[model samples]
Target: MTDRRGVVAKRAEDLVSGVPYVRGWNRARRSAGALADQLVLLGLDSDFPGLLADVNVFGDGLVHLGTIGPEAAELLANLIAAGLEAEQHDTATEASSAMRREAPAA
Candidate 1:
């Protein structure tokens, strides 16, 4: 299997480059919001002030993740992983719903 961190890093890179102009900015904002929510949920908001600041400043636009320090980049990678896992879980749940069966004779 592929390394999860590498996968998340690749995903982040794709999110940063997959689109252009307004659409890309919007996509970055949505991802930033999800990451920020995850940070707060994990109570790590204070641990990565720089990341939070960058998120707040560039959330409505695009962010240059390539220039962030190593610590911030690591935190971002973790957040991206969590987000991806959650998305997968949600997708699985939705797909599983189609396979649900009703109670038999009761």
Candidate 2:
């Protein structure tokens, strides 16, 4: 699988690097919520763990991000989207196979 969520992940990195600290991460809240909502819709409810992993990886690569808020929160949302996309892709592939087996030949 090529992992189709790479674009979202890249955007998150850009947001993290470019967006200045907002004292309390207010600017990143909406983006974060969007990510979380997308993940939930895609049925990967385990997004928080994946998000934490993503945040830790980001922190390790750069300066420690400290407590997640605002921008960091948005980054978490991106992580969730990435995870959901991956899972959904896999599930869709599986579903295609199942449907093929069940369908009558044309």
Candidate 3:
């Protein structure tokens, strides 16, 4: 399909709908603000971040995903959405936790 958003959303649906372990995909969420912040941290030179900034995910910050191109973007969004759908990740929380855990205590 030529519609980028549709393709992306569909891929995400596929992930959340596949595999026995994916039952957790039903409870994902992401705040548009947190998404924007992550996009900056990721440093990807794509419009995906801007697109995410406009998304209204109600501040959950992981329920949605995006990227620079149609094909690749769809793939990434799905991977993330999959983890989200499966309740295997809270990207922002996970990232921060990992950083904290890995950081050396001064």
Candidate 4:
């Protein structure tokens, strides 16, 4: 019974160790699919024939980024922060424009 338990535990541990890789693979696959969809939607598929392939490379890079080191993680964080800030700025600008349009002419 003890030997059987040990084998099961080892198998569980191995599966747990693979979780990160599985998650990364799923993320990369989704990212690639989204990129392909957007490319086709924008009609840029002909213009940038290799864009999807390039994006896949980037997706792989992102998947491995976390494993590289703290520096890579920090870089990714900074990118996310910058993107959020830009999105906020755009939203604010749009709101301001809408308000101005709605305001009664002086």
Candidate 5:
């Protein structure tokens, strides 16, 4: 069962009828989001702010997985769609980056 926030939705296949099961952009996006949330839970967000952003930035490319030359993009998008946190990672990263300063290299 999915929550009102759509944080936990039924598996994609259950939502679609008579559709062949395919691991695509949608799935990836969801996965990415979920991964983001998991990272937050694990406190990884505090240490690696760019982790989620990279996933989201790459996830955008997933939207066109099946088209010519779109396989890679699709893969990324799918990752984003599968996870909720992954989708919001870019914004979160930007916000955090603005609040943080880089350390001087030794």
Candidate 6:
């Protein structure tokens, strides 16, 4: 199945590169928090490991980000959203069938 969240998170990562500093990321703490909050609503923050690795891979972490403060600490929502989104399937029967297929045979 095509992973929409993965696709969107990747798109967001790519889009972040086009954003600049001074006016892009070098804003006050509150503004950054708001942006982070937006990302939360988009369920993108849960891809942090992949996203951070992508940032480090491109060698533009410093340029793409300034400083993250405590105001942006509400990251659990992203984590929780990951499981909830991942669990979503067409129906309970499909989910059970997939689980059964993956389960070890006794």
- Models 1 onward score TM values of 0.39, 0.33, 0.28, 0.44, 0.25, 0.22
What's the lDDT for all of these models? Answer: 0.54, 0.49, 0.47, 0.48, 0.46, 0.44
Off by over 4 Å in 1: 1-62, 101-106
TM-score of candidate 6 to 2 decimals: 0.22
TM-score of 1: 0.39
lDDT of 2: 0.49
Error of 4 at 3 (Å): 32
Among these predictions, the greatest lDDT belongs to: 1
TM-score of 4: 0.44
Model 3 clashing-pair count: 11
Question: lDDT score of model 3?
Answer: 0.47
Which residue pairs come into collision in candidate 6?
none
Local distance difference test, candidate 6:
0.44
Separate clash counts for every candidate? 0, 1, 11, 0, 28, 0
Give a tens-digit lDDT track for model 3, residues 1-106.
3243332223332232223323323323235555556656766435464443221112111244443678657656876898787665566678889999999999
TM-score of 5: 0.25
lDDT of 3 at 94: 88
- Pairwise lDDT winner, candidates 5 and 6: 5
Candidate 5: regions farther than 4 A off: 1-23, 46-106
The predicted structure with the larger lDDT, 2 or 5, is 2
Indicate the residue-level lDDT of 42 in model 2: 62
